[model samples]
Target: MINICFKQSSSKILGFNIEGHAEYGEEGEDIVCSAVSALSYTIVNGITEVLKISVEHIIKDGFLQLSLRDNNLEEIEKCQVLLETMLLGFKSMEIGYGDYIKVQVEEV
Candidate 1:
């Protein structure tokens, strides 16, 4: 199963951590994994490349983590929309692949 944890600070999202694989199909044919990867990468690119906001992130096999700490409130607020969109994508995936993906939100 894949685990997704979103870190929230005072009502705003600070970052997220996603780990593990869906294992829903053959390694290269897992649609669940592909969907999750697409959403994650898109959000990261949208924030860093498009929005030009610096963030802390780590990516590797079966794991991806991203966090925002030093950005000013304005930048953080701007990132909120993309983050929320990613969360929504995850939740939508969870609805369809409940046995493969799990999502949790934690206050920090």
Candidate 2:
């Protein structure tokens, strides 16, 4: 499962925190983690450029967490769309059979 939280500091600004989890066969756990990490990296890298913001920090554990700071509604909205696309792509990947993953988003 993946849970993403967004915090808006202003009308045109917000931050995101992402957490993801997967239930995969033992041999495929690493692949699951790698896929999730890659998705997070793509999101942060893409948003940083699209929004012209800096990624303050990123942490990985059972899930991944990304924090960014930006003040552009247009960019933020674009980022949101990109994030959704990435998540959907990850969901569609067949890295492991009988594995399950989920993504969620929230405004904080």
Candidate 3:
């Protein structure tokens, strides 16, 4: 039950939070965190040239927030696409693993 919340501020991408338990046990937890971290890294690396942004990973609450200073609508759109693509890839992997790991994406 990994929960992800995407927050939109003034139509320019604000940030997102990732939290919850993938399942019981340390291995499950680690896998969930690893997947999220990989996805976040991929997104940042993919759009680094297109948009200058800051990504914060809050360990205690399992939150990852990406904030963009530029308010360009095109940048926002690009970020959204990249983020979704990464998340979809994670979701596909989860399907094969079942409840061992999970990812939920929500727009806020």
Model 3, range 1-108, lDDT digits (tens) per residue?
A: 666656555543455566665663586457656776677666766777556644443445555556554446666676777766766776686777656555554445
Which residues of candidate 2, in runs, are more than 4 Å off? Answer: 1-17, 20-29, 49-51, 55-57, 67-70, 93-99
Poorly placed runs, candidate 3 (over 4 Å)? 7-15, 21-29, 49-61, 67-70, 98-102, 105-107
- Candidate 3: give its CA RMSD in angstroms: 4.2
lDDT of 1 by residue, 49-100 (tens): 9999999999999999999877789999999999999999899999999999
Q: Residues 48-97, candidate 2, lDDT per residue (tens digit)?
A: 77566655666767645554453345555666666566655654653342
- What TM-score fits each model? 0.97, 0.55, 0.57
For TM-score, the strongest prediction is 1
Error of 1 at 66 (Å): 0.3
> What TM value does model 1 have?
0.97
lDDT of each structure?
Answer: 0.96, 0.56, 0.61
Q: State the weakest 10-residue window (summed lDDT) of model 2.
A: 94-103
Instruction: Name the regions of candidate 1 deviating beyond 4 angstroms.
Output: none
